[model samples]
Target: MEANYVSKTAKSMQLHRRAKQVLPAGVSYFIRYFKPYPFYVDWAKGSKIRDVDGNVYTDYWMGHYTHILGHSPSRIVKAVKEQIEHGTHYGVCHELEIALAEQVVKMVPSAEMVRFSNSGTEAAMYATRLARSYTGKNKIVKFEGGWHGGYDALHLAVKPPFELLESNGITDGALRDTIVAPFNNLQETKKRINDKEIAAVIVEPVIGAGGCIPAEKEFLKGLRELCHEKDAVLIFDEIITGFRLAPGGGQQYYGVIPDITILGKILGGGFPIGGVTGRRDIMERMDPLLYERPKFSFQGGTFTANPATLTAGLEMLRNLEDGRVINNLNRHGRRVYRGLEAVFERKKVDAVVNCVGSLFQVHFTREKVRDVNAAYRADKEKLAKYHSALMDNSVFFLPAKNGAISSAHSEEDLEKLILETERFVGESGY
Candidate 1:
């Protein structure tokens, strides 16, 4: 043990403390904490990540659900190398953009048009704009715990404490117009839509931040019906669920299509990227030239269509050929979820494992975690203990209990995780 506010790796510890002085909260995103400090990664390959001090672990965080293919994949690296030599960002049109967009449109059934951006955050940002701009509505409906990004409108009602649902966010026109309801509660969802001004209802088909909860088949169908009847757009925030579920995203996996879909994560092949894929007419409204001041929704990025990232993304999608990666991913993901469930049973742990595709969460509570409220029943203290134990054992999962598997996670890797997890259950008598 080094100091509480210091990273285990001394050089990075110094770097992080300095970062704290210059950067708010010591890092960019609130989620990247090692908290009481951090761990500084020097490199990662395949399923393993290594820190600056030679500590290594089989990682399942998978870069917050981005690297479905793997880290430093040979094809992506090679493509990036080629693209870099050709020059990184032309800030103008290029073939890689066409290639990436074509692949998305070809694969996603709902996508007739595509626009690139820099992150899942950006994808969510523009999706709402399109929904509002095309529909000419002022209000929005979002599931409680459904997070799109930092934009103030969608930011409301996200990750609210269970007790504070009505009280979450500032009591103002922006927050008031935005409705919040529990996840998987269709009736409550409808109640919110009663507001005629609601423009879109954005949801994650398989929630990333909310315990990887998948929408029930009936629930999603009902949502689609509600959207159609109300003339409101339904947007799927597939940033976490897009390529990870299947090439066509959660829509194809669940067989419920939305009016608009925001995509990111695995699409970028480990590079920073995002996209809005939707109906041509709705998306065309985003064309600046169509508006008087050319301002339907102002959005641009210096690295919007950078060749290196797109080339890597193009190659990354290539690895999904013949359904090799997804088939294996689901098989492995189910195994991990079930194995953990069995462990909880044997250890008499009052816990449940929730999963969708390659994502899973170990909720340390007996409650059926259907919504953000249900997930809140999980024992945070116990989860922290489990996270620490896993990390100490060279098994790197999300420090907050969320986990994902990649094409690189082997049976050997998974069972190793299970065995370590068993010890956690047995010792804690959870």
Candidate 2:
């Protein structure tokens, strides 16, 4: 075991050192980097990923929660391959784009008209702009710890120290119109919305990056009512929850519809994509035909609704239409949640597992984690140690991030994960 660890460490360190010469912090994305460098995956199939050192792990990250069907599924791969043979891009409108848009409109409750973007950040940014245009208001109300994307407008208040900006280079003026509210606290959110200038209330059905804390049903209903009362667009940032919670995303699962919906992640079928859909009248403000009008909200992208991504996403949605995959993944997630809870109970570890649908997170605190602040208060050191130990046992989960269950995970994979988790609990002296 020691020899294997040394070998893995050697390969990862060598690659990380080479990466640092060109890439900042030796990684492309911030979350991909961690202490002692992150594992370099050679390839992944189904629920397993092999590192450069040839060590295999049962993967739970699932491409940052995007791979609901698992890594490099045959359906998506075949579609992409066929699409590439024809041509990857044409610089013109295609039939697949319309087909994909129709599927989204049919599935999502709020989707009457759909506009596509290349990433969740672009979709969310455009959603906010559409809301402002529709309401003729400037301020947007966002919950603390609810991450929309990396855009300047909605990037505030994603984590603790809520008063400060999440990233540098964001001016105070950029955040001047962004109002932060406490998640799950309907009263506090209502108070913040009292300002008549608020244009929208954007929230995550489940806090994905902040923590896998599901929003209360009552809270979501309250926001829907308040947005209608205030004439503000309520945007459900379902980038993480879309197609994972149900066929119509969070709105269908919770029976509370938002005025505007932001979707990405799973919709891409392991590719890059984002979509903004909402009421026809509101979405019409982005119509290129209305370019001469003052209310027009400009939204365009070079790679928006590309045929390759559309073909892959369409195939994924077709597979999900039967709902068996969704049910299986959610069941697997519940099993893991219950198993983890039992381990913590028997081991006397002061921990709580927050789960909703196929997403779950382990917090090293006894308190129920309903919001970002509660999650932040959990023991970070203990959680990291547990994650690292799990990694050592050939079980891979995103360190300090949530875990996602995919249809690719077989019963054997789940059983092994539970057994390994139990072993970690027994050996970890925390």
**TM-score on alpha carbons, each prediction:** 0.94, 0.97
Ten-residue stretch with the least lDDT total in model 1: 1-10
lDDT (tens digit, per residue) of candidate 1 on 1-430: 2342244567767767888998887888867877666777889988989987778889999888778876788778887887799897899998889988998888887899899999988888888877888888867888877878776677765565633543346446656667777789899778756656678888899777867778888888988998898888989988888877877879999999988999887888899998998998888887777764534765578889888889888888777745678978988989998999898888888888888888999888888887876776678778877888888788887677579999888889999999999998777665
Best by TM-score: 2
Error of 2 at 170 (Å): 0.5
Residue 305 error, candidate 1, Å: 1.2
Q: Model-by-model lDDT, in order? A: 0.81, 0.88
lDDT of model 2, residue 76? 94
Residue 277 in model 1: lDDT:
88
Candidate 1 versus the native: TM-score?
Answer: 0.94
lDDT of 2 at 338: 94
lDDT of 2 by residue, 186-299 (tens): 998877767557899999999988889999999999999888888889999999999998878889889999999999998988889999999998999898686556868988
